[model samples]
Target chain A: MINDVWILATASLVAISCALVGVFLILRRQALMGDAISHSVLLGIVLAFLISESRSLPVMLAGAVIIGLITAWLSDTLHKVGKLQSDASIGIVFTLFFAIGVILISLYAGQVDLDQECVLYGEIAFVPFDTIIWGSSEQGLDIGPRAFWMISVVFVIVLASILVAFNRLQTVAFHPSLALSLGINVVFWHYFLMTLVSLTTVASFDAVGAILVVALLVIPASSAYLLASTLKNMLWLAVIYAQSAVLIGYALAYALDSAISASIAVTSGVLLGLTILGLQVHKIRLRRQGKATLLEKA
Target chain B: MQEWNLIQQPGTWELLIEFWSFEDMNALWVLMGSILLGMSASVIGGFAFLRKRSLIGDALAHAALPGVMMAFLLFQTRDPLVMFLGALTSSFIGFFLIDWLPKNTKIKPDTALAITLSFFFALGLMLLSHIQGLQVENKSGLDKILFGQAAAMTQQDITLLAYVTVFILVAVTAFFQKFRLIAFSAIYARSLGVPVALYELLLALLIVMSVVVGLQLVGVVLMAAVLLTPIAAARFWSDQLTTILFLSAFFGALSALISTQISYLAPAMPTGPWMVVSLASLFLLSLLFAPSRGLIKRYWQQRQLRQKVSEENVLRTLYKLYERRQFEQNDFNIADIQALRSMPTDMLKDTLKHLCKKQMIRESMRGFCLSKEGLEIATQLTRRHRLWENYLNQYMDLPADQVHSQAERIEHILTQEQEWQLEAELKNRKSDPHGNPIPENTEGMSRDK
Candidate 1:
């Protein structure tokens, strides 16, 4: 039972980080860019492990950030310079990056602790065993799962960035040219937001792996985008959806003994479907009420 | 790091050579499968890219995951045909959802794509996990579809790939003109009664088929790249749709060849990413070096234009200098020429040398002089420049000052026909709005040293 709590905690933090950044991504119409960054960061993780010869958290995060920025920059270059359409450019860059990552992992299969399967589905259940220690062996304090703390830190950073830059982010997300007119550096904000996404994705990747991170990043925010009218409401609602997904996904996985990360992704998707259905129901109810009042007046 | 040295083993090169020689039957099958996958994907993907629905492949590929799992669950067999039908059905469902969502709700197409993609992928993952937990035989290989395993292609898989490839190619060829019409101008095609929506549905079906066929090799996540990138790269090579489709298919086949060889040589390396990487390499190559629309070619053309503009500016400046000197002499010092055009000394010297090489100008120890040929060419240029200035001044209603800058840009680009049109529009006036005399035509003038 305690183990489930840690798993759910870590999953919630991962969800929060992804959802916070994902709100801006969906609003800025860069949902696929999140997908691209999540995929390419695998290459970063592989390279980081290879270069550092160890799976140090900071080293992997740094590598993920650099590669994430490269993916964003290269995709932008392909769109702007190569004259490819935005979707094609994105499709080309991330797949190429991800393929390289997969190739590297396969080539150095034994040297790197990462495997193809782990890179795909992730081993979030095992995350609890990788505890962070605070002192010497004699009096070391367990601070719970390292992934939990890592994602929590990232969640806070994402929250602070959004909270501090809300207006600028909202302006940039809603209307880039308008933001530019308002003296916001559109490119800087784009990359800054991307940096946050990269950080969030890398932190979540330890718990959910590469592909499932995309689910966490896009699904909650998409549901929120459907449900909420304001960006503020959307962010809060995304957090709500993400937390609910974590808890319910944990319960489903616990019952079925399935892959926890995938279960979480599935649970969130189910939540999104329900959200869509509910929104439709609410809309129909409002229409019926409006018609009834109109008929009474008539 | 020691693992990296395996490539340097004594027989590694020999193994690569043998693999590329197609002596190995497994290698040959994988090669055939990849080639068919590439060709079909690129050809059909051409239309998808044209319609700006390139990401539909991504969504469909991801959506096919659940279908494959469902096929395995229902039939308890890894039959390629069953899986194909299942993936086709599932992706069609996904395609309709993607099509319906944006129309029915306020969700945009890209958002719709992301939603369908992640949702279906999650469902697939959930099913796969449950399947894995069930301890089913042959369950392990199903995960390979996420990243693709070319070595996993049985003879049956190859046959399936070939059939689908042939089907897609035949259908696309038969409907070539109609597909092209709908892709390029759907509203216009509809007005002409071409049944645009039916064609769109057919194209979607074709995309779903190609994606399903290629899924075994390229996998779900990167399938869209295989479909779209080759066509995008091929676009740099040609403008004609037929040529683009041909080049795209060729690029796809070529990448498949290279990726399959690498996968064969290094068994540890997966074929799909290598295929993607190879495709990207070709795309980068096309983007950089294709003759017509390539980056290098565009750069060279720009440089050529800059040189021509500079050379013409020098000629115009020389004529102005001759005019300022009251048309008394043809020779002028390089410094005086520099003072007139604000050009760097060395660059101006090179232009002068180039002109002299062409025998358009004569260079003496003291100064530079336009030969008779140069004078005639320079006179024609000056007349065009002045005529364009007058045209812009008269027709665009710009002041004389503003017209000079406008004519300065237009003079270099104006064709002979446009020059004549400007002359006629200006009623063959001898003088411009600023009252500078437009030099008359000096045909039949002989060159002099």
Candidate 2:
């Protein structure tokens, strides 16, 4: 029970971070990059582990950041120089980097147990053992694992970044050219946003891997976006959705005795589908009511 | 050791020689198929770019992943034929989901795509893992799809690629005019009795073709990149239909060649990455070097135009002041001319000298005045400005104050015929709404000029 609570807490923290970063990415139509970040994080972790010969958090995150940069750099190059559509550039760059990571894993199969399945669908069963300790065990209530600490810290970081940059971010999200005309560095803000997304993604990859990372990032944010107009409301709704998904998904997986990551992914996807349906019904009902009132006035 | 080094040690030419010696058939086949695939994808991508449906490729590519994986597990094989059919069916399904979600539900394409892509790919991942647990790994070829392993090109793949290309080409050519009309204006096309549904379906098929053809080269994840990048690169080259088609093909072929070369140089280098890099490099070059749209060309054009505008502004300002009885005598003083505007004395002197060389202005004792021809030109311009102001106020229902700015923009743009039509429409008003005299008609302002 304690172990389950610890894992549930870790999932919630990571989910919040992903949901937070996703709010703007979806608004800017850059949500797909979140999934790409998850896949490419494997490359970062592998390269970092190879260099440090240890699976430490710093080394792993350093690797993830570098891979994220490479992914972002390639996408930028494709967009600016290649003149490819932004989405196309993202699609091309991340998949290629992800493939490179796959080949690297295959080449160094002996040193690493990472496979394509693990890369695409991360295993949450092993997350509990990867604990973190700043000092003595005598200290009260250790923050569980390094992954938990990483995500909790990442959640706070993402939350702070979004809060600080929210206004400029909203302007860019709504109309990047308009933002540029206002002398705002649209590109600078965009890269900063991407950096935050990559960091949050890396923080989550240990628990959910690439595909689920997108499920966590995109679906809740999308549902929230569909239901709200204001960015502030959307962000809060997405956070709420993410936490709910984590809690519900953890409990459901516990009941089914299935792989937690995939169960969470499917549950969130279904929830998104349901939310979309629910919103539409609500809208139609409101429209009918509006018509009824108008008819009464007439 | 020489054989082991695929790129630096043994060049493509050498590889060709060795292949010919060994009678390697599969390599030749993959190369041929990739060329056909490359060409068709670019052609379709060009149209997609024009329509701004580039992201649809991103959506469809990811949507097809689960289908490919599910087919692999169910069929228990790595045959190109079955996997492609699986991909096509699934891509359509993805397309259906995108269209359906919006109409049946309120899901936007972006949100629907994101949802579908992740869900489908995750499902595929699960199926793939289950299959991976079995011995022989019947679909090991499936893993190569993520980034694409184009170098492992086989004869069978080439044949399939050729057939698909041919199939797409026939469909596109058969409805070329309809496609263009629909692409340019759907409402007009629909009103003109064109079957909007058929054309739209063709477009969806073309998008599916773009995705399915490159499954072996770029895979589901990056297929959209190949489908969009080439067209994007080509857009900078020409707006003409024929030229755009050729350039898109050129970019596509270049990407294929570069990706193939990369795969050759680095053994086990996946086809998708190589293709992406190749396409990216080609796109970059086009963006920098393409005529008219390139940064260097635009910058130079703007610089030259600025000089012309500054000169034109100085000449026009001087002539207008002379028309108001400010500087009519010979040997005009430059200081008085500078005082009329906020421009410096030296700048005003330079403008006076430039106008003198052009015989349009003469420096008088007081300041600057228009020469005979310059006076007529200035009168004509001022007359057109007020005429437009009068016309807008009387005919277009503009307020008196609003007509000045509206007429200002129109004066610089109206053609000779348009100006004459406006003159005729007002039936020769003696004075403008502002009570200024309208300029007399001149043979010089005839349609020929």
Candidate 3:
């Protein structure tokens, strides 16, 4: 029972952190950037593991940030210098990086802490087993779940960054030239948001793998963007939506005997579909009411 | 002992010999299959690249996964044909959703693609996990589809891939012109009374077919790279669509040959990444070194143009110096020329040396002098410069002084024919408005008396 509690908490924390960064991505119309970063970070993990000979969090996160920045920079260069289409550049760079990661993992299969399977769909059920103790066995501190702690730290950092630079991020996303005119350092904010995304994606990888992290990062914020009118409201709504997906998806996964991460993605997708349908229905009702009022007044 | 045996196993050279001798027919079949896959994918993918729908191949690949898992769950079989049909059905549906969503909804195309891709992939993951829970025989290896093992490809799989490759190639050939029309401009094709919508759907269908066939080898995640990278690299080599298509196929085939060989030698290495890495290497090579559009070529051209412009500027300056002396003096100090154009002394020296090598300029007792041929070239440069300045002043209505700076850059680029056109257009004007004489085009040592 406690293990299930830890799992739910870890998954929810992961979902919330992803949704927080995803709001900016949706506003910037860079929804696929998360997808690109998440996949290429696998290479980072394998390389870090190879070099450090350990599965420590800081080393993995450091490697992930480096590769994530490279993916972003390389894609931008390909678009500007190579004159390739923006989307094609993104597709090529990420896939090439990801393929390299896969090759490395397979070639040094036993030497690394990862397998190809776990990289694709992570083993989140094993989260509770890997505990981080704070002291001796006689009087030790059980830190709950390592994934939970990692997601918590990532969530705090992302939230604080957003709160601290909310205006700059908003101006940069909506009007980069205006941000520049306002002396906002628009490029710095752009990389700032990307840093948060890389950090959140790597932290969440232990719980949801790389592919489903793309889902967690994109779906909720996109759904909220469709419904909410303001940026602040969208952020809140996305968090709520993501948290609801986690709870409901956990239950659904329990009932159906399916993967928890996949279930969460399915729930998010279904909710988005419902929101689309509901918005359409609301517009139709408003139109009918407007027509009746006009006829009666006439 | 076990580790020792593993380390003592046959090395790469031995494996290469075996691969060449065809001692392992499996390797031969895998190689042949990859070659066909490469050729057909790149040919069909050309249209996708041109239309800027490169990522659509990615979405289709992801969307096909659910159908493959569904087929397996239903039939309890791993028949390639069954999986192919299932993947095709889902891919078509996905293509439709990606096409239809943006047209009908507030959601943009990229968002729609992301949603559809993740939605279907999530479904596939769900089903796959269920299959895992069932503990059925052979369920252990089903995860291999995610990253694809070429060694796992059977003889039947290769045969199926061959037939699909032939079908895709023939279809693309038959509809080549129509595909080209839609890819270039759908609205224009519609204005021409072509069935644009039908051809668009046909092209999407072709993308789906190629993506599905290559899925087992390249897997769902990286299949789009196989579909798109060859054409991207080939684009650096040619602007003509036909040549690009041909070159794309050749690159695809070549990468497949090398990657397959590597995979055969190192059984531990998977084929998909090796294929993708090889293709990416080819792309980087073309991006850096292809003759026409490569970075090195463009850089070289720019460098040559810079050198030529500076050289020409020096000769024009020498002519102006002669004019300053009222046409009596034929040589000027190097420092005087340097004062005229604020240039590096070393660059000026090299420019002077280059002119001397070409017999355009010679070192005088004071500094530098224009040779007879050099004087004629300098006269033409000065004439072109002054004429452009006059044209800009009279037609463009600019101040004569402002025109000099504008005309300075244009003088190097204007051809002799353009100079004549300028002369005629300006109605035989012999002198610029700034009171500078525009000399006639002369040869050898000839000068106006």
lDDT for position B95 in model 1: 97
Q: Which stretches of candidate 2 lie over 4 Å from their true place?
A: A1-9, A21-147, A160-199, A205-212, A223-263, A273-298, B1-24, B188-195, B292-301, B321-327, B330-338, B342-449
Candidate with more favorable, higher DockQ: 1 or 3: 1
| Native interface contacts kept by each candidate, as a fraction | 0.69, 0.36, 0.62
- Which scores better on DockQ, 1 or 2? 1
As a whole number from 0 to 100, the lDDT of residue B346 in candidate 2 is 69
Pairs that collide, model 1: none
Question: Number of the top candidate by TM-score?
Answer: 3
Residue B185 in candidate 3, Cα distance off native in Å: 2.1
Q: TM-score of chain A for candidate 1?
A: 0.94
Error of 3 at B442 (Å): 2.4
Q: Model 3: what TM-score for its first chain? A: 0.95
Which numbered prediction scores highest in DockQ against the true structure?
A: 1
Tens-place lDDT digits, model 1, residues B244-269: 99999999999999887776666556
Better of 2 and 3 by DockQ: 3
Give the number of the best model, judged by lDDT.
1
On residues B305-362, what C-alpha lDDT tens digit does candidate 2 reach at each position? 6554444456545555554554454334655455555676666566667767877777
DockQ metric for all predictions: 0.65, 0.30, 0.58
Q: Any runs in candidate 1 off by more than 4 Å, and if so which?
A: A135-142, A287-298, B1-10, B13-26, B329-331, B344-346, B444-449
What's model 2's lDDT at B368? 62
